[model samples]
Target: MKSILLSVIIIIIISSSCVNKNNSVQDKEEIIAVLNQQQKDWSNNDLESFMDGYWKSDSLYFYSGKKLKSGWENTLNSYLKNYPDKSYSGTLKFTIAKISAITPDSYFVMGEYNLTREVGNATGTFMIIFKRIDGEWKIIADSSC
Candidate 1:
């Protein structure tokens, strides 16, 4: 009887672990999809849609150049000011360098962003922290150089 109970307990533990691992993989894929969509939106000059990947919260943080911006509204405003038109917005591309789970519900992503424009081209690296919020992966913090 004791041996049977122990065997059952071990099986339960193993099953739970497997389920967790599967969920982690799914989460990673979902996060990557969000990033890809953002890139696509940017390329299309749809800033509003691209911002969908970011957390729509007052506490959302974005760091670019030497300035730190807080709140979704502020970030949106900054983007508008910087890229007011299609020519300024240019075409955006992203190359994901690394993505790892920080916790069950949080992930860290490092990538390179390139903007090709008729005026000039710019390239930089970015690191973003994503959190599972309301069943969706959203960027909670972004640091782009």
Candidate 2:
């Protein structure tokens, strides 16, 4: 009986260790899903829905083109002011270069964004940090240039 109990313990530990090693796969998938939804939201000119992926807190940070914005509301305001409408907002497409884990609950994504609009087409690289908060993943910081 003791030997059986010991074997079970060993199996449990081994299983847990294996799960921990590959846990990032699940996280990556979740992050990708969020990005996909954001892309769809932006393409539909749903800025509010796009912002749903961001951490709705005063600590949220955003930086882009000689502008620095802190707080979720400020970031949303910036998007509203700059984009204004679908014509200006354009369709946002993201080509992810890499997604690296910063911690168990945090990751930094580097990618290129392309905007298709009648006014002009714009492209740039961006680095955004996502952190798991309140059982959901949210963008805590964004730097686009």
Provide the overall lDDT of each model, using Cα atoms, as 2-decimal numbers: 0.93, 0.93
Q: What is the lDDT of residue 108 in candidate 1?
A: 96
Q: Show the lowest summed lDDT stretch of 10 residues, model 1.
A: 80-89
**Every model: Cα RMSD to truth:** 1.3, 2.6
Off by over 4 Å in 1: none
- State the number of backbone clashes in model 1: 0
Looking at model 2, which ten-residue stretch has the lowest summed lDDT?
Answer: 17-26
lDDT of 2 by residue, 1-145 (tens): 9999999999999999889769888888899999999999988889999999999999999998887889999998888888888898788899999999999999999999999997899999999999999879999999999
Task: Write one digit per residue (lDDT tens) for candidate 1, span 44-137.
Answer: 8889899999999999999998999999999988998898887888999889999898999999999999999867888999999999998999
Q: What lDDT would candidate 1 get against the real structure?
A: 0.93
Candidate 2 wrongly placed segments (more than 4 Å): 1-17
Error of 1 at 144 (Å): 0.5
